[model samples]
Target chain A: MDLVFAYLDPGSGSIIIQAVIAGIVALPILFRNRISAVVRTLRGGRAATPPPPSAPPTDDRPR
Target chain B: MSAPRPGQGLVREPGSWRDPAGFVYRRDGAIHRQIAPVFAAEWEAYLASGLHDRLVTRGAVLPFEDAPIADALDPATAWRVIRPEMLPVISWPWEWCPGQLRDAALLTLDLALEALDAGFTLRDATPYNVQLRGTRPVHLDALSFERRAPDAPWGPYRQFCRTFLAPLALMTERDPRLGLLLRSFLEGIPLDLAVRLLPRRTLLRLGLATHLHLHARAIGRNADGKGAEARAVRLSETRLRALLGNLRGTVAGLRWEPEGTEWADYADRTSYSDAATAAKERIVRGMAEAVAPTVAWDLGANTGRYSAIVAETGAHVVAWDIDPGAVERHHRALMASGRERITPLLLDLTDPSPALGWGLTERASFLERANAELILALALVHHLAIGRGVPVEMIATFLAGLAPNLVIEWLPHEDPMVRRLLAGRHDMAGGIRGNVAGWPLFREEAFRGIFADAGWEIVERAPIEGSGRVLYRMRRSGRA
Candidate 1:
């Protein structure tokens, strides 16, 4: 007999689904500081001036 | 492992069977976890990770020992069996006060950060995975850790938000009574629900905005097609750490000072004279020392005064009270003192925690876990008898089922506290006096007769001077 195991039930699966989408939108913002640095270097300028450390990503952009 | 003896069956703890990685079972009063073959890779990697050692060292996780038990219920499925050190008392999230829940949430985040540092991630973040080792929250699931993938988001993010962040946020911003919401949503408080309940000002807080409000909106918008499409998304380890740090900061910052409850100031308003209070304390202390139980349950343990007394004798005491304010105060004291033997929890003795979740066995009820060798009912019987209108016989029967020996107090109807509880209440008898109608036959002799009939032998009884309260040390019949 073949046995199948499900690690994620519906509740967990749904959460993972939502978290995945949020991750897509949030990850770039999370690494915006780093991304800006790389972008500046590609344009031959120092990475976009790193945001003040006190400032968290305050962007309310829709995902 | 060896074959089981004929007719010797293993008892799988009902609440623990849900997690597929393993199931907790008991044999001859010993608690064991059976790691399944499906979880072998993760289990082996976790054992080698030193993360377990780190957590066990700091008492963050309950330590277990690899043991070769005689048999497994299903040998084909069992990869390894380990015997975990049993916690004296197991409690749930609903029973936790605001402070306890916050501490637990912070513990989960701390462990998550540490696990990420160790190249592993927690698979889930259910509050149920955490249990109190005294006042400290200890993670109980060994298989919850999995090898971390580079640039992968934390798998338990939603769970953490629902179980820890949302509840803490509610208790901090709203009323602590919102903590009871966990009793219904066994999985967790839906992020959407939390967002709706929280005030608009909370949106200004980054942690609340990112983890709860925005997350709820994201979940709602992506309800059908979005999650599957976004599975390919990845988060760098640095980003994951930052997320966890934000959660930890939020949890650490949230605080609620327990106040304005009728029972929070109980000890201050007590009618006992100084001499009588000392005598009562001496009696409780003497009885506790006499029994010397390894585990003690103090029912209605307001602020845990007697519980502290029991703990001083090297016994683990689960101090339970219905009043959230009192439980919160007791928990704060326990945390401040770093008391490692007393656990304070919120429990309504009249309506205890019931069987909940799938098949109604996911979480054990109060009575299922209330058993202890020594039980203290100080100043509690009257509350159950008069405050709740439970008959003395029913209360005795329930208390008898909890422990073999009991230290109980009987407050006469004339006692000030009892009178206050009975005041202005309609009497059931419909006599000219309105107060007597609802009052049951709570006479001292009747109470003793009920306990005696319930199979308890009174070991010692005393009336404190200056008060009409009688304390009895009753031993269950048939127990030495």
Candidate 2:
């Protein structure tokens, strides 16, 4: 974070816009699992099965 | 005494780390002092005495008054109030001209003498505490003095040497312009550096030996142990007075006359006819009148020719130039004319003052403090744009950040001065491309594009005949 702020020139608005985009993309990914766990715990763990992932994961296994 | 009024918005100035005992704040455009409750009794007694009035009247210290304590109550740690006489501009020692630094040093010694006589001793002795009020020096930190240290051998001796003596010695012995070292070592020139920088001949001088040479050795030896031997050398009041007198004599003996520079003789070499000069002055006066700035900065102000015109608009003008000789000439002109509002300082815009001191909070960075109402960058952009290889957009952005209003002069490469700078430079392919090619490659459109990028709007532009110099009036989008 310190590096980001230091490197971002105050006069350049593009750096700020890039930072906002990065933040948006990373925010939900960082908290999605923890948030779901908290929601389950708060509901007394009634939903024992896990929910599906937000997006399907692609696989490329070596034969 | 009661607690301060709520919502008075008297936030402590964040830049008082050098002073640990008290802090300064601004409320309703008036400066206020807040003494730490630990030293309340001493502060009260000091104020009650006539010493405060004496110091203020003699122009040694900033004047202040006891403010009415607010009714909101917190008996413990209640802060004292003082409305100090505001300084028009606060300049650090690093930014000070050699004469100003010398004056501040003398003023500090004089204040120390007076404080001792008043049964007090100066606890802090940093050049940052002193500021130029007109040509004279005045102490800005009133809380630096405390009750007399009857036994202490000038408790602030090390600080005094670091801040004043070392820099003065280096400036006098090596080069008058070596004072710029203060900008690098903000806590005062490092004693170790000074010891190395001083000439071998300096060892012969008793003052240099006792003050700087021995002082640095003492600091190194006593880095861990108790400083008993150093403290053993005590001065009687008479001896201390003599020491101060000696310091004054030493400083008085040291002098630097800005001798030779290319543009120092610009007034003589100018091709401008008398009528042309008058016309330029008229345009400058018109711009100043239009802006009516309270604080103006004139960049590249050669001998303060246009700076004087800006000051004529009743603004406090800070004239800055890269050439010390030019600044010196401007200062002499001000002295001769008895002009109080104009202050000439030496500064190189390509490399301005940076954040310095402990945690970079002691003295304000140049850009942090350079918030002038009007900035006059006359005949300056060409040097930055062509000579030093700075982009025109970057220059515009920097200027826009400094002031709300700008009076810039665009000098075309066709001008003889520009031709002189372009001489003897490699014409590599990558080096000179696009508008960078040919002197005066940038047209008004380029200037407008850069200014617009920095959120500025051009109000007017007047081109001078046969000179290829155009004066512009621009305002920041927000306000004057």
Candidate 3:
């Protein structure tokens, strides 16, 4: 990151793609998280809370 | 405009010219961020809304303190100047190994997601906004966040793809060397280029397909202004969250194994006998402990075997290696072992990372950001001296500028590694194939005079018994 903040270009094409796929791009993740949340609830939410849509997996490591 | 102009006691950071909200400058030897009057409101809200505090607590961003109003060096341009925590070293995305880059990408996505909850948003997403301390990354750009733009498409959508997503996919699917493409495409690898290089099977991965292939096509289509409504499109916070989630999943799913790189297995497959290796390690450990430097650079640090030893002396070690695989593996090991002192980076000394971006100073050249107090050149001299055909004189001069003390090794021609390298070369003047009598690197005479001329005086010299290799802990004489 050379020293600048993105003075926020949000290129036209990228915005268009996001517009085209925003509805379905996250379906699988949404469904997976929803299912996991329900499972956690059914298990009485002992150690973990039903996470929000954007929360990282419980631990920080993605690998 | 109250912008930072040339010729002030304040030296505006080179890469800061791109950001309109604010720019960082050094005045009186302290880093101060000068916020333009236009961004004053947002800067205030960033603190009042407690976003700064929240992110600081999570180690998400570099914490800062508001300096007294009188301290503003460029009062005309400075609405407010705040002092930010100093980042000891800055390593660019090109030098980051896969794991480090992956971690940086994750941090970018995570910050964006967290910002949304506070009714604020990340106006842009780029790896440059983040800095790594060891394996941990912290956001560096404070001006990227703003109150959410309702009904607006995520402004940094392409920036994210170009800067993070594309290179990541290329690295995981194509080759880790493609990650070095960041050096060429500082804006991030072009999506179309990434799409072309990625295997066709990647189209099956939904997130990649949409963000890369479809994204590239959309950009191309809009290049002609056909999608005039791209700016008019309304993205609900819900949909935006969905987009963020998708990007996170795609990035998290991308993986690159640190195996099969040229030097990944070099440590275990040694040219020296077990006794020689052990003797070398002991010697390196003793010398590093004696110096006890705060920071050490292990040039050509293959697997960080010696870097780990240097760090044991309680120094923060920056382990740089030419091999991406070796750096990646070393970084992963450090992360797994919870060691935060050794930062493994990808660097090819023959052609090191340069000061690039705006004015070629925004991104610092490798030498520009060098933070070594002791340099470990173990088993590395021969490679740079012969493998790259760089003369010992230039090599010594370069090392002199990197640190005040040095632990370097000299391998004679009879040494198996040098012999293996020499077998392929007929010329030995000073290059890969130069005539020997002119400059035989195998002899210390090849480097001794050059080292002295470069202002390095040998403090101690120890020869590895049996391997015929010599180790010297040298003290630098002049200023680096």
Candidate 4:
């Protein structure tokens, strides 16, 4: 098993780990906000109005 | 040089035992460092503070990345990952010409000074850590430094002196070529041995007095079971800074001008007509277009005149020559031209890099690591053939193993240069011979017969206009 792991490209391995960590960290925050909105609506609370979508096009330049 | 069996978990390198911290082989073609669990936090702190980055940026140390601790079977143990930009060759200190060795020594001291300022000290000081990357010194041991111990004296101080200071002092004061001591002693020269070899007058030099003389005395006192009282000499940070300054001053003062090697005189003596030289350059460029090698090695590259032609075609080239003066001038030319791809190294092909360190497994041998697609061995066979008395078949056999495609120049005895080589030697000759006896020299039949015996298929041959020299492009065939 150690020998098999050693043969894998280090750059490829680092990229895979980075992706996995990003997904794991993002999932919890996404689920919590969705749950809070649903609960507030069930309690007959007024929904928070959405913000205006009049913002300029977002900058997409790479760092 | 033996290959390990398929399932071996971690093939502990034979050379690893010399290092205090264990080094292990990973299957990915990279070496990993495994520090003791006690040093784990210190290693992390050292990396987090940008010390590694600073050293690497300065070319003082090899760079590494933090590896997951869980990678190890024992979660308690921690490790670091280093993917070293592979060197074209691992030159032993013994093989280094005087100037090359001096450069390595000065670079080591420069790294030590920078490392100390980064709040860490080197654990081991060995010349093996310094490797030449394009005529520039780059440290190879990524895990050599650790967080300084507040209570312990600087651990590697004496070692630094032995590995760099003593060798440099001997080369400067006595004979420049004394750096060859590295070959006889795998580790740096022993301090006691260095003390003996140095002249009595060296004892009068202030820097040598304190470092080599007193330092060796301190080690001797400790060995004699002298009380801890004698070992209690401590230095303030200010004094330590002064010591480092003194070392830097000493290194800067010692210099050697590479001179007096046969090939160093080659540029002035070369017999090529201007048109012939230009034609040779065109042939090299055309060959480079066909092969398109990412990396090429030019063997016997006398001052790298033809190597530059291949370099112009956008290939990284390692121009190797046996002559120190020639290599020095070649390196200077490449530097002045702002050419980053050409690396000139001093090497004698008669005896190449051997497997070194314990059980001969620590460093890769010469042929074990070779560069890419094509190799140019132009105008060099005569030296190996007539000068060294090596058979043509033997020479072909060696070149075949090094690269897939070879551009070889066959200089017939009728060539002026070939006549110059034979001017002094006994004329017992018939021709360049194979294992079998009695052959005619430089005949086309003899050349073909030798290449065939060595399992190389001649692909192309072109004769030079003004000389009997013919260039042959040969492809290696599958036969051992």
Q: First chain TM-score in every candidate?
A: 0.33, 0.32, 0.45, 0.36
| DockQ of each model vs. true complex | 0.10, 0.00, 0.35, 0.01
What value of lDDT does candidate 2 attain over all alpha carbons?
0.69
CAPRI band for model 1: incorrect
Tens digit of lDDT per residue, candidate 1, span B290-397?
A: 899999999989998899999998899999898889998998888888878899999888779998887888788888787589999988877776567687788888
Candidate 1 chain A TM-score vs. reference chain A: 0.33
Q: In candidate 2 chain B, what residue range of length 10 has the lowest lDDT sum?
A: B69-78
lDDT of 4 by residue, B1-480 (tens): 668554345444455555434354453454555665554565677778787788788766766555655443233544543335555555666655555666776776666556667766666666777877766667887666666545324445555676677777777677655776765567567777888888998778766766676666656545533333434544433334445556656566666565676788796787778777777777777777677777888999978887888888887788888876787788767657867667787667888777766667766677876855788999888788778878778898888888888888877666778767776455533433221123434777788778867888887777766666777777777765
Native-referenced Cα lDDT, model 1: 0.79
Candidate 4: C-alpha lDDT: 0.65
The residue ranges of model 1 lying beyond 4 angstroms of the native Cα positions read A1-6, A9-63, B1-9, B424-442, B478-480
Order of all candidates by lDDT, from best down to worst?
3, 1, 2, 4
lDDT tens digits by residue: candidate 2, B123-228: 7677888876655678987787777645444555566777888888887677767888888776678677899999988888766765677667656655643434
Task: List pairs with backbone clashes in candidate 2.
Answer: none
lDDT of every model, 2 decimals:
0.79, 0.69, 0.81, 0.65
Predicted complex 4: CAPRI docking category: incorrect
Clashing pairs in 4: A6-B28, B431-B439, B431-B440, B431-B441
In CAPRI terms, model 3 is classed as: acceptable
